[model samples]
Target: MTSLDLALIQDAYAKLRPVVHQTPLFSNRLLSQLTDCDLYLKAENLQITGSFKIRGALNKVSAVAQTNASGVVTGSSGNHGQAVAWAARFMHLTAQIVVPTTAPAAKVEAALSYGAQVEYCGTTSHERLERAQQIAKDTGMTFVPPYDDPLVMAGQGTIGLEILEQRPDVQTVLIPIGGGGLISGIATAIKSLRPDIRVIGVEPLGAPKAYQSRQAHARITLPSTDTIADGLKSLALGTQTYPIIERLVDDLVTVDDDEIRYAMGLLLTRQKLLTEPSGAATTAYALRRPAQIRGQKVVALISGGNIDVPTLCHQLNP
Candidate 1:
């Protein structure tokens, strides 16, 4: 297994600087007042492809582009598929993305618009991943493990580097967790640089893979998941991401769908930011427990803004 370290993350940063956006880290007075903390928002929702997943996708695809592989295949709930498709297009390689049958239509369409072949599999990350791997084998394409590869984690870690640069005084960093790639990468970067900073991961209550895994002290898969955050319904954390998160992440917490909905509405109405439920999860955690991080300098990472209009209206109205 390849080790994930600060040096590897830094190298990813250097390589991705020309491509990925250094997303903004801005503070909102209203959110700070609500959480009773000095809060900054890492707006990866405004990132290219409308999420931070592009960072990892570009980095991973670029590496694969150097090889003789004809193309790449992978599975995603939504955002990762779009990112991979976009990255594959940018790198001049073909892509085949296996998405869950229940994945958000907008995200699926976005992937298709990028000229990648799209396949619908069972409505779970594991199921789609199995199908994607089989496709890779049959097509002689490289299988890019969505969140499990070292390169993907290192690429995502570039967000940590940006956060530290954007806010050197940040005391706590809250990131939404899916297969643990985002948190694992950012936590490793933050802990390696400023060990004092707290790195917390927020997951949907219905899909608390990271939280449950931490409790068990080992990686475990859930039989099913239920959440509005389609991008966050992974049944398990990546094998490569789990150990890094276990060692470096400070804590893991979960928020119910209603809370995530509330946070999404608040972000749009008050903060003037549109985020999908998965993106607002960290904010939901902070809003639900203001006293926990009171008086601390907190950075809540908004992971994506790819919700469809119908879902957005329903969530906002609910």
Candidate 2:
């Protein structure tokens, strides 16, 4: 199995410096008061391609461009698909993205806008991945695994390096979990650099793969997932991501859709930032468990802001 380490993440940071944005780590006074902690938001929602997935996508695609493969194919709910499409375009390669039929129209359009051919598959990560792999096989294109590949994870880890540099006194970090890519990468970087700092992961209560997997002491694959955080509805943890998370993550927690919606509303109303449900998950946990993390310096990573207008209105009002 592939592994992630600090050195690999450092290399990714060096490689990405010319391309990726070092997004802000800014604090909101109201949020800090509410959570009773010095809370900062790692604003990857403002990153290029509108999410941190671009970091991994660009890093992976740049490496693949050195190969003889004609192009690249991958599956995503939305954010990663957009990143892959954008990266492929930047690298001057043809790209194909397989997304679930239920993926948001805005996200699909965003991917298409990057000039990648988009195909709709069944409404599940597994189905989309299978179809993407088939396409790659038939076309002799490289298959970009969203969260499982070491290059991708290392690329994502660059965020951790930025976080530590931005806030050396950070006591805890709350990251939203999907297939464990984001959390696994960040946890590896943080723990490798500052072993004393806590790295916590938050998941949607409806899709608690990482939380459940930790309890079961083995990877757990859900037959189905239902979550308002569509970007976080990964049915299983990545094989490569799970082991790193298991070893380095301090704790795994969960918040329901309602909490996520509340967090999104708060982010918009109070922080003046629009965050998707997946991005608001960690903030939701922090709000819900203020007593647990109070009196500490905490950073909540806002993973993305690619929400459609209707969903955004509903989340803000509901």
Candidate 3:
């Protein structure tokens, strides 16, 4: 698969350091022991606004600095919306975020806090995207898709730049799957530099597009979706992300909702990292498939930490 050029990603890292946090790359001895590999955690959960969504969101918003974005429009139920809204505010631009009614109020409030005008719609994320597209077209606003753009992918690729430097011996990387932004970005950059470093993306079986898409040899927009991994509830991989995954991603593993909850519990008890279900996907994958990771130095990209409190309380029953 064609991967991103490392120099380009490095340049993006240079551009982003001021706004983006260089979240820690800490070794998780317990996780490593579970996976039978040398495992490190990419604490992207500690990033600004608690998610890596900012990297791509900022890159896209900043790219439009010349246009001055009359208004920016995008569809998201969570992190992406907040990221876009935050980036828009940073650029002194107006942002119009479309979300489904099912999205958490905390996320919507966070977006509004950053000065984005919020619109809510139907039950499903797909319905929200449809509304967002119409809003962009009707208003002459730029529609920023969460994972469909090359520029955004390149921006997200900054994670790969960090990975290579922090752990050169990393033989494997497990990243959470959403619209496929995080994995696509990291795979594009890391595989280019260290072709031997296998990139295994983890998706919740509750939201299984990445795994299904890989098996089909094409992007499969699932007819319907359900999962506690709110960040990964997208129905399909973006066109931009699909091609990259087919080329660069080494494998895609899926874990069910219960497994995800178990992983989250493990993270809290074992690593002292408070992660949302989606963020724990890679770790769950590693635990389940330890044989695949045995003897290798691995990293699980803990993508974000923004779990809704009530949701966590219910899921964990603590």
Candidate 4:
């Protein structure tokens, strides 16, 4: 397992504070009434690059830039790609991002706008990895993994720190899971500091890799992911993130596409938050499965706000 401790996370927080936005955490009255709990939204959709991926990407790039690397390479469904491209630009380093062909256009354009070379791979995590690895090998660029690194996880743990400082009385945190980096980091930080605070993970039912992995006691690669939450469509969990999540996270739950769209619509209309489907999964779980965390001060992480206009219109109207 990776050596992730409180000190390492604190260092990441200190390093990232100047670079990343300390995103807002606010309680929504409408959502609170609906969930019958004191509900707070960690609006990371408002974060730099429109997602929390910046934290980890920035952390990784900073470390790699120290060695004066020729360039940086990474793979993502979208948000992480944008984040890496953004961070690389900020550091004045060349970046090449490999994304699945099915990735959202808005996200792809966002990365391209950062002056990074964007390449299309197949529509799976493994395919993205293969292309990214090949690019890294050919160009002799530093490969920045989207997740599965201690430094990256430590950077993401900063979110947990901010949440606790923002609301010391928070009873529970509902974090969205992709490849498990965000939840693993948050859960580790929360469980280490305030052991009383519960950390729950939310995943789309169509891409329940982490949930299935936990059930089987090993990683389970899905043949395909069939969810509207595109950012959470990892085929399997990383070795580092999986063990940390299994040990630190208190619970795991899933939301369907319908529930995700409902939550997304609610956030957009009621809370005036433009959250992507993956980010909205936590609130979806809260609304669909209330028994698990009712009557608690809950904070749901909004992972990103990169949904396309057409998709948003369809989700909101459908």
Candidate 5:
């Protein structure tokens, strides 16, 4: 289990300050009453790129600018692609983003909107990584992995900083896990600063790579994931992230698509928050498995809000 120093996370916050939003941390009394505890929402769904990925994307691309790299190549389900594309545009560099065929149309279009050259590949994390790595090698561009680098993880840790700053009494944090970068960074930052805090991870049951890996005490790759939470469908956690999760993270849980959808509806109607399935996953875990989080000051991290119109309509209507 590797640990990042507070200094590193603080540096990430400082670097990201000018570019990123110090997103609000809201406490919903309704959520607190339902869970029998004080509940806070880290509304990262309202982030600049509509997700927290921009923190890492900007951090990595800014570091890339110091070198003589030709451009940047990376892979994402959607939000990270847009974040990287926006970061590249911010630095006046070319960005080629390889996305899976399963990636949402809105996300691919969002990347294109940010001036990235979008390439459709196989619907798997491995496939996108291979393509992005090859592009970086052949084009002399820097390969910014979606969730497997120190700089990226450090950048993502900035959210943990904001959380503590906003609510120093935070007892537990429920963060959605995809490739584990977000959880890895959050756990690292929180544990380093306040080891008493509990860091729990939420993943869709359709894609329980992180949960399975933690149980097996080693990294495990899934054959496929059939979750609607596209942002939480990575086949496996990163090598860099797995150990940190195993070490620093308190627990990992999974929620089904129905649970996610129900939570999404609650977020929309009850909480008055717009969130995609992936963003709603943390709330789903707390709502579905309430016993674990009862009586604790919990923060549910809404990771993104880039829901497509059809899915949004379905979730809203259903």
Candidate 6:
């Protein structure tokens, strides 16, 4: 329905095979009992780049590979920084990644280790993008947008493609939304495949652009947000992704930091899964409002595993 199609995603899967790991899926019996749903966890946190962002990063970079340019540039909250840096390295290209001032030191270090030049910008993700774009234009770099690119969304769609095929009767697919790349791509593929399936997007209550956009039935902007889930703190929804979501996504939900922390603790204690706050948004929603999504064959994406190790260790055994 958008610029990207299944063929493009298929090609991306082929290109990504060498670089990205096919993350595993596992049955969550405790989650099932708690939420009264046949819940499956798509362990994207265990993905090769430690998040689903690598899929979009590789697809976007490969789309520009034929241009044979000097380098590419992008801005991110954290996960996308690592993804772009990893992709740039794999493709043998230079990457200039811009991050907001609040981005975690651990994430920035990972990007640097991947050999990308990292820059710190304003306090918000939108401001970082503005800086990144200007640098790309001034330096003749290919501007690799985090979520506003068709290629990026298509790559993220592959997650939905695999989920539907793996769990044929999946009734709901819940994904966390920051800039909307992952949810848009996933909603596009899954809704196209099975119109009856529900596509739910989770956002942090403090960072509610996606929820606002859905409410307005048009693109809505966010001023700023302060949330512990730094990865979900985008000031606006993605441009290219908004259309896909307007057409495909069935519903949206939100969770607060306390809920996220509770979900993270539950996963650590009950499931032994180490998830960042953003990745645990779906579980938070499920736990907070079980009756709404209960008793469904649901697929929830644990979108990243790049937690602060010491922070997680303290939470786990505290």
What are the per-model C-alpha RMSD values against the true structure? 0.9, 1.0, 2.1, 1.1, 1.7, 1.9
TM per candidate: 0.98, 0.98, 0.95, 0.98, 0.97, 0.95
- Badly placed stretches (over 4 Å) of model 4 are none
Candidate 5's C-alpha lDDT?
0.90
Give the lDDT of residue 87 in candidate 6. Answer: 85
Give the better candidate number (2 or 6) by TM-score: 2
Residue 185 lDDT in candidate 2: 86
The local lDDT score (0 to 100) that residue 149 gets in candidate 2 is: 90
Query: In model 4, where is the ten-residue run with the lowest total lDDT?
Result: 285-294
Sliding window of 10 residues with minimal summed lDDT for model 6? 309-318
Predicted structure 4: lDDT: 0.90
**Candidate 4 C-alpha RMSD relative to the actual structure:** 1.1
Clash number for each model: 0, 0, 1, 0, 0, 1
Per-model lDDT: 0.91, 0.92, 0.84, 0.90, 0.90, 0.84
Query: Per-residue lDDT for 43-121 in model 5, tens only?
Result: 9999998999999899889989989677899988899999999999999999999999988888888899989999989
Give a tens-digit lDDT track for model 3, residues 109-167: 88999999998888666788889899989998888878777667777899888888888
lDDT of 4 by residue, 51-163 (tens): 99999899889989999897899989999999999999999999999999898899999999999999999899899988899889998998888888888888889999999
Clashing residue pairs, backbone N/CA/C < 3 A, model 3? 1-247
Task: Tally clashing residue pairs in candidate 2.
Answer: 0
Residue 18 C-alpha lDDT in model 1: 91
User: Which 10 consecutive residues of model 2 have the lowest summed lDDT?
Assistant: 285-294
> After best superposition, candidate 3 residue 240: deviation in angstroms?
1.5
